[model samples]
Target: MLHNRVPHILKRLAAIVLLGLACVAAVHAQDVLRVSAIPDEAPTELQRKFAPLGKYLEKATGMKVKFVPVTDYAAVVESLATGKIDMAWLGGFTYVQSKLRTNGATIPIVQRQEDATFTSKFITANPKIKALTDLKGHTFVFGAPSSTSGHLMPRYFLLRAGIDPDRDFRTVAYSGAHDATAAFVQSGRADAGVLNASVWDKLVEQHKVDPDKVRVFAVTPPFYDYNWTVRGGLDPALRKTLTDAFLRLDPRNPEQKQILALQRTVKYIPTQPENYAGIEAAARTAGLIK
Candidate 1:
């Protein structure tokens, strides 16, 4: 009986050791490349769009890549600053916020060709609304406050045109995303709305928004926008590998074309932190950040 009891205790101890080893292995497996993007669109749409791109990155870097989507634009900036994520796709203003929050530790790696000259489109259900001044005393909607093309530049241009959204509009609402802003105007929730041009074009192309109802009344001047940003202190070699992978995507290739079309980019190009200086200044002027 003593020998049998001794064997049972030994077996239990061995099992516990094996379990500990397995836990460590699981953790090591999870040491993957974590990626996320600002929720500029629906979370589900973001996940669908990123699935193929995540696979392509994994194949390129020889590491498992996971795409995480956040509900708000600020969350993406905060996650990148806190190192909760390894990399992020950020808008110009979001990148500016991350840079300031991280004391200029955030790095902009690549941006879409369209991003270099991005613009915002103001749409309205009211046919009489033909200019920025026409929005006065009408309900207005804007995308996420942290969005560059969606909110910052749009508001900046509106002010430049001598129309203040907050004061002039009967009601100012935040729609949280570009698509939602269009929907707001289409549904009569808002008399007019502003959003990124890329989303607006996509919506028009896909027939998601009826051209007969909501129409673009104004388009802001070109400005720098979205980019792929990585956390500071990342391995230099890994960063290079990631950047090269993005730059190597050939839009002519069938598979790569699908990804590019989904991303609304003709190609990805190298970008620097300096490209967003104007955006930072705009945010400061708007009193969005100190």
Candidate 2:
């Protein structure tokens, strides 16, 4: 009976040791890379829209990349700040907020290569409206107040035109989504609105927005927009590996082509924090945040 009891205990101990080793090996195999991507616009199906890109990155970086899609722009910023996410794709407004709030927690890695910059267009219902001057005295709508392309840059353009966004327009409303803002103009609900041009363009590309009914009143000067942002203090080797994979994603490559379509870029361009100083200044001037 003593011998049998000893063997039983020894077998149980061996099993426990094997379990511990298996757990460690499983953790080591995961090599997880957590990522977050802002919905293209408010209330969008981000995971549904960007899943292909997430899968592409997983393969490219040889890690188990899990995409945490965010509908609220600000939440994405917070996630990056807390290290809940390893990387993110953010608009300029959220990016600026993340930088400031996270103790400079992240830096830009890439942006769309089109025109080598990103910009927004002011759309108006009146066909004759073709400049910022035309926006004065017209009822205006903007995307979410925190949106860089939809609100901050557009308001800056308004200021440049000698019209204070807070006081110049007959009425100002936030439609929350660029598509809705455009709809407001198309339906004659508002005279003009500011929207993320890339988002609007994608809608037009998808035939969701009528390009003929509402035309661009003005195209703001090119400024940075969407960027691939990664947390600071990331392991240097892993960082280099990931950045290189993104930069080298060729349009001809099937994996890259899908990512380019989602991001509206031919290829990712290397970028840094300083690249967004202008956007940060724009947000501050617009009084969106400190």
Candidate 3:
């Protein structure tokens, strides 16, 4: 009788342990979806803009959404590749990098309508700088070296126009952000600078940068740009859910409209890996990525 009782006690303990393991697995499955974006703007501004979107996503997906801010552009790519984050808002160039690093395991889900035809602006405080060619022999600043509109495409177009920024410019500086690039030029630390046209326009519209001090001297031809990318191994069902949530944002709805406007987008549209081929090609041409 004692032997039989000992066997029963062991079986009961094993069952209890399995039950606890199952509970832990269930809780992990419902863990909060972590999101992050390239530090293209001030961290404070990114947090402010993403807060409402996170709440909206939480309601849409029935999962808590937390917005994580990073210190630089590459951190977003690294986070997505290592599965540290569920999704990220990546510039075209950064998307290319993540795709390469993950061996195409990162997937693009959605992009703004504006992203399909994004452009960059070359700005300057000096009247003598009339064009990209004129930027030669003068100090110039670019936004983050990894930036698509702020650095990559702008450099690509400059090279196309026969101006090699590294060799031709007297000095080159990186401002780390579009607004900072404008401020750098305005403050005379740099004679000319380049940044995303949307950022430049916003700065002008907000009167954050005086028009008289800094003005657009050139605009790069349009190209594909920012997008929401997810890690490759995400459950297909969840990926579709995330994509659908973005598409559901209606500009006609005031609340959704505010979210879209804050993102500088008209509406979110589904995107595929092929959408970034041109961007990848541009990166290769610029020798930014292998």
How does model 2 score by TM-score?
0.84
TM for every model, in the order presented, reads 0.90, 0.84, 0.94
Which model, 1 or 3, shows the larger TM-score?
A: 3
Per-candidate RMSD, Å = 4.0, 4.0, 2.0
Per-residue lDDT of candidate 1, residues 1-290 (tens digit): 99879989999999999999999996786459999998889988898889889999999988899887787888898899888898999999999999999999989999999999999999998988998888999999999888898899988888788887879999999999999999999999999999998899899999999999899888899999999999987888989999999999998899998888889887999999999999989888877888
Q: Which stretches of candidate 1 lie over 4 Å from their true place?
A: 1-31
**Ten residues in sequence with the least summed lDDT for candidate 2:** 39-48
RMSD in Å for model 3: 2.0
Please give the range of 10 consecutive residues that has the lowest summed lDDT in model 1.
Answer: 25-34
Sliding window of 10 residues with minimal summed lDDT for model 3: 25-34
Q: Write candidate 2's Cα lDDT for 1-290 as tens digits.
A: 89879989999999999999999996774488888876546444566556787777778777888877666777788888887788887878778888998788687777777624678888876876777877768898988777778788888877876899778789999887777888888889998888877877887888877888877767888887777788776777777877887788888988678777766778777887888888888877767776
Residue by residue across 1-290, what tens digits does model 3's lDDT show?
99979989999999999999999997886578999999988888888889888888999888989888888988898899888899999999999999999999999999999999999998888999898889889999999999999899999999999999999999999999988998899999999999898888888989999998788888999999999999979889889999999999998999998898889887899888898899889889989887
The candidate maximizing TM-score is: 3
